[model samples]
Target: MAYATLEALIKQYGLDAVLLVADRDQDGDIDADVVEDALTAATSEIDSYVGVKHRLPLPQVPDVLVRVCGDIALYRMSSEGGQLTEDKRQRYEDAVDYLKRVAAGTASLGLATPPEQETSGDAWFEAQPVRFGRLL
Candidate 1:
């Protein structure tokens, strides 16, 4: 499944905003093909970072990935036309920074890692009630 969908992009940034970036053909509507290409590129960029710590083609698309993908795809679309806005560039940079942290194991996707892929050793601890030194 795609990390982010066109519908989600429209919902997050509004249809007008999506059209402004994605309507490359200027057909008075969002050019879904253009959006799809941007999304595909964004997904590949994310996979490059995430694949380092997690399996490729993640079984489930995390919500955070959805937002990051949207940011990246929109930025790519805007950049292609030299219409890149400060906000779009900032969002794209933030998404990449977050992905880098995830790849470095400093952040988490909140998914349970497989036992075999877990890097830290299992830990267990037991505690006993304290004993009184003196009793009345």
Candidate 2:
């Protein structure tokens, strides 16, 4: 599953705003279809880099991922814009780092495995919680 969708992006940023940034022409013209294609590319790139297969849908999507997708599309549409500020670049880099961390967190969660495999036999007993008081 894609981490982000065009509709969600549109909802996050108003249609006019998203179009202005994402549209290459920037003529106050917006094409949902073209914008969607850019979103698809961004999603694919994110998934590929994060080492997450696009087939499994994440239970919860992160807002940062959505923001990254929008940023990526806007950057591409800006005609090799040399005017991007250092802060924007820093934020983009930070977003990518956060994405990697999220992917790592999911990997640790082991969500891809079956429910039964979440805990098996001695695995649960290996690290039992400490108990201070006995029940009556």
Candidate 3:
């Protein structure tokens, strides 16, 4: 994943930071040092983001929670086919549930509002018509 893209996403969403976690699956061995290096590079490129390596116990993996401006956008990045698993999906749902519980009270991260759409410089040009005739 490109760190620049991640940074742009954060900025567009007005998020404080994003949490990244990774794990290896059964029969899949990866070099910890190499992974660490990649993670370091990603963090260096993106500000306020933290990466952590976790070892999941049998039948379960760690849930990832990203606290952005008090609202959490949770995600699960699975090593298996690099797809999100049901457990992680559930975790994300649970996070939303928790958010509703404490929405009325104050929190350390603060309440997060809905993310705003990012504007592009050439957005209008893309939708406008172009002159095809030659202009002397």
Number of the predicted model whose TM-score against the real structure is largest: 1
* Candidate 1 ranges beyond 4 A from true positions: 120-136
| Residue-wise C-alpha lDDT for candidate 2, range 91-111, written one tens digit per residue | 557666766765655423233
Worst window of 10 by summed lDDT in candidate 1: 116-125
Candidate 1 lDDT by residue in tens digits, 1-136: 5689999999889998898988877888888889999999999999999988888778799999999999999999999967899999999999999999999989998876645457567763457877867576
Q: Model 2: clashing residue pairs? A: 1-54
Candidate with the larger lDDT of 2 and 3: 2
Which of the two, 1 or 2, has more TM-score? 1
lDDT of 1 at 72: 98
**Clash count in backbone of candidate 2:** 1
Candidate with the larger lDDT of 1 and 2: 1
Number of the top lDDT candidate? 1
What digit string (tens of lDDT, one per residue) describes model 3 on residues 43-125? Answer: 33222222111111112211222232112221422332254556556654664554344333332123232222123434322
Candidate 2: Cα lDDT at 36? 69
lDDT of each: 0.89, 0.59, 0.32
